[model samples]
Target: MNNTYITSFDYQVPIDKIPIAELRQVFIDDFSDHVDDLESPKFQNITLDEIEAVSVYQNYNPGTEVISVIEKVLTDKSDGRELDLIIDYSVVSKLENGLSIGNKIQEQLNARNALVLSVGNGGCLSFMLALKTAQAFMQANDQYKNVLLFSEDHVIGNRYNPGLNVLGDGASAILLQSETDSTMQLVDVECYNMGRLNPVLGVRHDLKGNFKYKEFENKIQPLHYKVIYDLFNKVLRNNSLKIEDIDLVLYQNMSHNDYVGLKSALQLSEDQLHYGKMKGHGHVFGSDIIINMCHSTEQGKLEKAKNIVAISSGAGFSWAVSLIKN
Candidate 1:
């Protein structure tokens, strides 16, 4: 079951990246006075530098551009690798108004006609869906020597809610192959979902007419680490492995608090975790997993690991995990 470690994983992003936006502007029919006011120092004195420093609001969704970045990562190192994609339902679900996210992705990758080997919904279980997709695709396509696994998502599904700060707009691509190289190896995977907790994290509409974030300040919501730690232990127990055997623990960065709790719950030292810091990247939705992997590669932090486990949890009350040997 040992193969070459994940040799190279890369990513790209558009320069003109736009963030999800919200604005409160009242329209004025008699615009002359309003225009005069807008032209005053209150508005005119504002410099582009200051504006740039201030985060811009995103009114449009980022889809193909993000997927394009994922494809870039795949094709860059895909010379001898197979391609598999684990797409989160949120990327293309009608409820989120993302019906075209998947097809647009296929078009960006020139894979519109490619066989849909497997498809599943993570419901907030994005990580599990991804791993399940990888397992199924590998089993179904033995001849598929090189595989490309990818996932992309936007923050629009959460209605641009500020509470979902950890969620960002991004995409990820991992090139897999039958032969081993210097890259990280895909050892095994374990996944589960807590659908009962689905109501705690989601997008809902209120009288204001826009979607609102649900669970931003719930202290108990972070108890998800207990759920994740239990599932992780279950996976290790099933495979006769121990947490100490794991060299690195890559978990989704929900927030600083989640990371701290997960670290204590998992009994992991600080070095065992990847860059768990919550930057302004704004909770990249489902792309955080690969994003962290790519960051590790860039920082040369992935070495000295015999085994590494990746864990991801999302709002659908879902969880996905995988064990990789480096």
Candidate 2:
């Protein structure tokens, strides 16, 4: 694993609809009649201009989405080689009978010979944990040739959680190999878990079955800024790098205000951060950073960038940062 590389990656988000307005209307027409109640401030304050569009899946399950993303990656980038392991980072795992989502994905991929492992409950940071786990597996076992990391989440059952940004449906896949000629290379990774705020930002079902978005905003938002700032500093220090050395910082795709808050906290300029994906794609749970990176590379924004940092924060009170060099 001396020359481990992310050879190629691809992401899939259903684009049958455009702009957030259309999606909202579709939801309103199909689910509820009280439009004002659905658009209440307690749910979310995002405007149409702030969020251009989001992908939605009405008939696909998480396991099927995972398999679809894997097929896309293999068909478009891979060399028709079999994978050694498949690691899934789905926060909401849909279980049928007794089988888990990971097992269903493995069975669908026909990778019965490959090892399957799932990491859940880490929210947006789950994929970072999966990446770290894949690296460890490769380093520990020389026989493991390649590993695949997949992440996908959607707003199916918990659509009323207003503490979070507007939810979307999307999936991303990354292929890790021992030797490849890709420009992007994984340099270092770090993660921290602060469980003090675990219950502040998830779906709440009490007697009224109402959401606690206001409480989450009041209690967790301030802590989020501090935690992100500290994690960024820690990763920079641990890697012997400075803020100026980072060509691009790809943080999670939240609202515009959240991005501004982070930029102000870090005192970074617009050129130092890449967050244009948020307006068009919104937040896709664990796949936000990966989707941003892929789109940035495709748009040629990363051609001259030498070092990039990808960071994410999850509801479980976990933060992760990964340093990539090109």
Candidate 3:
């Protein structure tokens, strides 16, 4: 049950949009109507739709591309180690019909279950997908010796939303299996969702009102932090752990300000919090948390700790916290 080590990781973003930071900021600006203080009167005059149009992330399908890179990455990283099971997800926007993503992967990988966490009308589909993936992995009879947890989201094509284009599509595949043969151990997991809200914070649509994205601000939406704090507290409390018990805090890829607020709330030290290639890769949607964990290991950050916690949050207005012990 011990001696797990994350061997390697592989990542690829379309060279066309290699610099995704610019796109991300554009989307952030488009959604900036919610900013505390608006400097330009022109922004006030612009409609939300106009702003959304500018923020869209385009090109590159993270789902299919993620799988290709992940299969190659995991296999290379495993270095001939035999896997007992694999858990994977190629999540795309509901507007994009993610079911096909799963089908595409099923063609390549030998997986027992294919779960899809559709956002419905909520924006935090990533959080929901992660929650589902963790729950399924934990509940399984441990019959599978190796598990591959994968996530991918692509922005272009379906016009998921104006912000979708700004989000560079990417995928991450993690090999999870017996602690004896595994690289990283899954210690604990927690999840919380904003039960009361309509979940869809942002909604966009075509001129015909077909469907775009109904937007919601995570900052203004207390539900984002509320569920996050609640889930984190529960995970620690149930495990009889204090904030200091965590060696490192791996947060979901989020805005810098949001990260600060979370660190303050969790009382985490700067050294204790880690984010890997997040800005460089843009948020890999649902793969953010897992990718960070893998990236941390690949970069030798996790080598120092025997215990770590991974916290993730997304638009379904949800929060998830998972702990691992090395």
Model 1 scores a TM of: 0.70
Measured by TM-score, how close is model 3 to the native structure?
0.69
The sequence of per-residue lDDT tens digits that candidate 3 reaches over residues 19-104 is: 34343354355544333334434223322221122122255443456666667756644432344434444445322553435445
- Give per-candidate clash totals: 31, 0, 32
lDDT for residue 30 in candidate 1, whole number 0-100 = 23
Q: Tens digits of per-residue lDDT for model 2 on 46-88?
A: 4535777777776775577667677877764554246788888
lDDT of 3 at 252: 59
Deviation (Å) of 86 in candidate 1: 7.4
Tens digit of lDDT per residue, candidate 1, span 1-326? 32423544544433333332321111122222222133234232322121111122244454544555555656556532134342433432222453535555555566633443323255334644655565556567664445555554433322222222323445555555666555566766666656555555432212132321223234325666677788889878877898778878877655554566678888998888885433545445455666677677567776767778888865555666788876
Indicate the residue-level lDDT of 101 in model 2: 75
At residue 66, candidate 3 shows an lDDT of: 60
Candidate 3: Cα lDDT at 192: 57
> Which candidate's lDDT is highest?
2
Question: Between prediction 2 and prediction 3, which has the larger lDDT?
Answer: 2
